[model samples]
Target: MPSPRNWREIPARYRLEAARCRGCGKVVYPARRACPACRGQEFEKTMLSWKGKVVTSTVVQVAPTEFQMEAPYAVAIVETPEGARLMTQVVDCDPGAVQPGMEVALVFRLIRREGHGGILCYGFKAVPAA
Candidate 1:
């Protein structure tokens, strides 16, 4: 059971919420207090488009202990049309097939289970856009 504050702090993990900096018009994901581009404090909430293009990607042959079972996966930096970029796992296809400029759609999925409680963590994963 996550606290309300925990959930509130990460709307982007669940809903793709982002912040548009009023100062520089930069859109940042995982909405932060200050804009990275202009160091602005004012922002307007925005929703990122579910679809994006992979800017870069790599096939993970080695993974941390917690993720070894899911190794040989593809990790990519995806950029939305709004200019928000996020690192996300790419799934539902061959890892070797993922490449830069590939189109993908962000989808809500289980990331992993944590602790003895096996609390399921959920986040977005990118899949090949049909």
Candidate 2:
């Protein structure tokens, strides 16, 4: 079964929706209730551009129980053109190939299956930008 929190984040996960603080022009991903930069309470909904650059990355050699089969994957903090950064797995390439400053594009993909019932979860993954 999908967690209630995951259900609530569908808008950000599926559409790359972000909140832009009107006061400071700060763009925050996953749509926060308040702006962290300027403590602004008002925001405007904005859609992030699919393309971004890897700000940092790490290769996960040891995986959690759910992701053991996919061990040695690369996870990275990607920054979109709108300046919103989000952590996501880098896919469709060698784990070591992911590097800082590497360009990437967000793509919808199967994230994982939840629980014994195997409820499928979908989310975006970063792939090398064409």
Candidate 3:
């Protein structure tokens, strides 16, 4: 529908990094700028696989003013291999078909167009794995 992949898109630099607390086992996605569990500032950049299962999901039947046309889209919280859970949209499959525990793969995708004069946001979306 839009350009294949917009760079200015959201997460233009969605590097899959996680912060596993050196003080604790709790991990943060996007690699917390700082550890929330122990307030520990030290962290190692760990790459996480996009592969995961749908932990939870909801299909929007009526989009919001910010996402009007996107209504009826399936959104989910995916649990990654690194154990970090992330909230995102489920694409490439029927929204009605989305369900918990469904295997999914992450992909960079366009999310929304800013009103009138703004950048086209893009980010990762999970889809049924082929």
Determine the C-alpha RMSD for candidate 3 after optimal superposition of all C-alphas. Answer: 4.7
Query: Candidates' TM-scores?
Result: 0.91, 0.96, 0.78
* lDDT scores of the candidates, listed in order: 0.92, 0.94, 0.77
Off by over 4 Å in 2: none
Residue 17 of model 1: what lDDT?
93
* Model 2: per-residue Cα lDDT over 61-126, one tens digit each: 999989999999999999999999999999999999999999999999999999888988888999
Residue pairs of candidate 3 with colliding backbone atoms: 9-122, 10-122, 60-72
* Number of the top lDDT candidate: 2
Better of 1 and 2 by TM-score: 2
lDDT minimum window of 10 residues, candidate 3: 4-13
What's the best-to-worst order under lDDT?
Answer: 2, 1, 3
TM-score of 2: 0.96
Candidate 3: tens digits of C-alpha lDDT, residues 13-114: 376656687777667786655777788887766667878999999998887787777777999999987788888888778998999999999987776775
Q: Distance from true position, residue 79, model 2, in Å?
A: 0.3
**Candidate 1 lDDT, 1-130, residue by residue in tens:** 5557656755878889999999999999888899999899999999999989999999999998878999899999999999999999999999999999999999999987766778777889999999
